[model samples]
Target: MISIELFAIGLVLKGPEIPWWLLALVIATGQIGGKLLHYYAARGSIRLPPFLRRKSANERTGRWREYLEKFRANCHRRPVWTGAVLLISAASSLPPFAAVAVIAGWAKVPLVTFLVTGFVGRFVRFGALAIAPGIVIGWL
Candidate 1:
C-alpha cells in the first residue's frame, strides 16, 4: 500500500527512500488519476468529481490547461528540450502533483523524452534529500 502511495506521490512530492519500483507504481497511479480528472472535467460541467476539483476553474486547473497550451506553443518554438524544461518546472506547480508528467505522458510525449527529463528533474529534487544526506544533515 505504501509503495503504491509512494509511486503516486513521487510524481509530485519530493522525498527519499521509496524505491524506484515504488515510484514507478505511483507514476502509474498518478497517470490514471490525471486521466480520470481530465475525463470528468472535459465530460461536461461536471469538470472533475467533487473530491478532485478543489478550486474553481478561474482559479486552478482551468488555468492549468491554459498553461499546457502555452507550453505546447513554446515547445513548437523550440523542441523537446523546451518541453523538458517546462515540464520539469511544472513538477512544482499543481498540488495534486504529477499534473505535468501524467499529462505529458497522456499527451503521448515520447516515453524516452519524458523519462529522461522527468526522472532527471525528479532525481535532482530527490537528490537534495534522497541522496545528499550529508549535505542535509550539515544544514541541520
Candidate 2:
C-alpha cells in the first residue's frame, strides 16, 4: 500500500483534481480487499499440510515462527495491544499490513472487527494523503 501511496499523493498534487472522499473511498476499498485476500491466503496456507508440517531449521522459517509466536502471545495476553497494533499497521507503513493481516487471521480476530478497523484506518491514511497537497497549498 505504501508502494502506491506516493503515486496517489502525486496524482492528487499534479494530476486532475479528484474529490477527497472519492479518493479515500477507492483507496480504502482496494487496501481492505488486498488485505482480506492476504488474510484468507494465510489461513488457507496454514490449513495446508506442508505449512502445518514441523518447522525446519531454516532461518526464514525460524523468523516466521517468531512472528507467529509474538502474534499469538499478543492476541492472548494483550488483546488491546494487538488491536492497536493492527490499527496502526492498517493506518501506516510500519509493520507491513500483509503480515499483520495474516497474523490477525491466524489469531482468529473476528472478521467484522478486522474489516471495520481496516476500512477506517485505511480511510484515514488515504484521506490524509489525498488532502496533503491541498493542505500544503493552503487550498483546504
Top candidate by lDDT: 2
In model 1, the runs with Cα more than 4 Å from the true position are 1-70, 90-97, 131-133
Each candidate structure's TM-score, on Cα atoms with residue i matched to residue i, is: 0.41, 0.76
Index of the highest-TM-score prediction: 2
Clashing residue pairs, backbone N/CA/C < 3 A, model 1:
7-26, 8-26
Candidate 2 — worst ten consecutive residues by lDDT sum? 45-54
Question: In candidate 1, what are the lDDT values of residues 5-111, reduced to their tens digit?
Answer: 34444543465455644554445445445444443344343444577554554554577678776765665576666555634553433333345544554344544
List where candidate 2 sits over 4 angstroms from the true fold: 14-16, 45-67
C-alpha lDDT of all candidate models, in order:
0.49, 0.79
Per-structure clash totals for the candidates: 2, 0
Q: Taking the tens digit of each residue's C-alpha lDDT, what string does model 2 give over 36-115?
A: 97677666643546765447556545776787877777687876676777788889856887778987887777677688
Candidate 1 RMSD to the correct structure: 8.2
